[model samples]
Target: MADTLQAGDAAPDFKLPRDGEGFLTLADFKGKKLVLYFYPKDDTSGCTAEAIAFNGLTGDFAAAGTAIVGASPDPVKKHDKFRQKYELSFPLLADESKQMLEAYGVWVEKSMYGRKYMGVERTTFLIGADGRVARTWRKVKVPGHAEEVLAAARQL
Candidate 1:
């Protein structure tokens, strides 16, 4: 397993395909606060709810000088469907190789009903304008998560 990232650590760089087309990188969010969240899959119950919560707060996040981006191992096509289905206001990154997920320490071994496998850990990283992680929420529960993240980002 990879060492978990913490506040003050430098956020990892990634060049990933996004929902519509083109790519986004960590540098794209430089000099701005960012909510970089990693989820298990697109269109899943928890993931959809989380995305909607964030989407609902998009204007608020922007007012706080923060940008929100979501990442998952699902492909760009899936991301497109998911984003359209929810009318998500932010970009959803595709990490099909799981490389970015591992670098962020979100890809991990999970067990459900005694079936063990690798998947995203439902994590969120609040990165400051300096590119250092300001806060990290691991094993995140969906309920009120976006509001919590917005509060934290506002503090930053």
Candidate 2:
């Protein structure tokens, strides 16, 4: 895996398809803090819950000048459906080629039921306005995660 990013490290740049048929890049969030989260799938239980949690706090995040974005291997079509189903307010980035995932070191070998496979590690990064990573949370637990991220973003 590429060296995992840490606080003080420059956030990697990316241009990815979003749910509504446009691209999102780090530069798009220039001059604003960002909450970038990576999940393994679009409609799974944990993913859904996390998306909803973030959506519920969209106003709070905006108040803090932080933009929330979610990225998954799913295509834009699936992302659209998921967002509509949950009424998600933030953009869901489609990283179909897994390029951004690898760059962020969120793609990893995961084990479940004694089987090992490659998947997203359920990670979140809080990037400050200057494009440096402010904090990172790996192996994220869905419950109350958005709240935790918000707390961290507020500090930034």
Assess candidate 1 and give its TM-score to the true structure: 0.97
Off by over 4 Å in 1: none
What total of clashing residue pairs does each candidate reach?
A: 0, 0
**lDDT for each residue of candidate 2 in 62-118, tens digit (9 for 90 to 100):** 999999999999999999999999999899999989999999999899999999999
Q: Give the Cα error of residue 87 in candidate 1, in Å.
A: 0.7
Worst 10 residues of 1 by lDDT: 1-10
lDDT of each: 0.93, 0.94
lDDT of 1 by residue, 1-156 (tens): 345677888888899999999999999988999999999989889999999999999999999999999999999999999999888989999999999999988888999999999989999999999999999999999999999999998988
Q: What local lDDT does model 1 show for residue 13? A: 87
TM-score of 2: 0.97
Q: After superposition, how far is residue 115 of candidate 2 from its true place, in Å?
A: 1.3
Candidate of highest lDDT: 2
Scored against the true structure, residue 71 in model 2 reaches a CA lDDT of 97
- Candidate 2 deviates by what RMSD? 0.9
**Per-model TM values vs. the true structure:** 0.97, 0.97
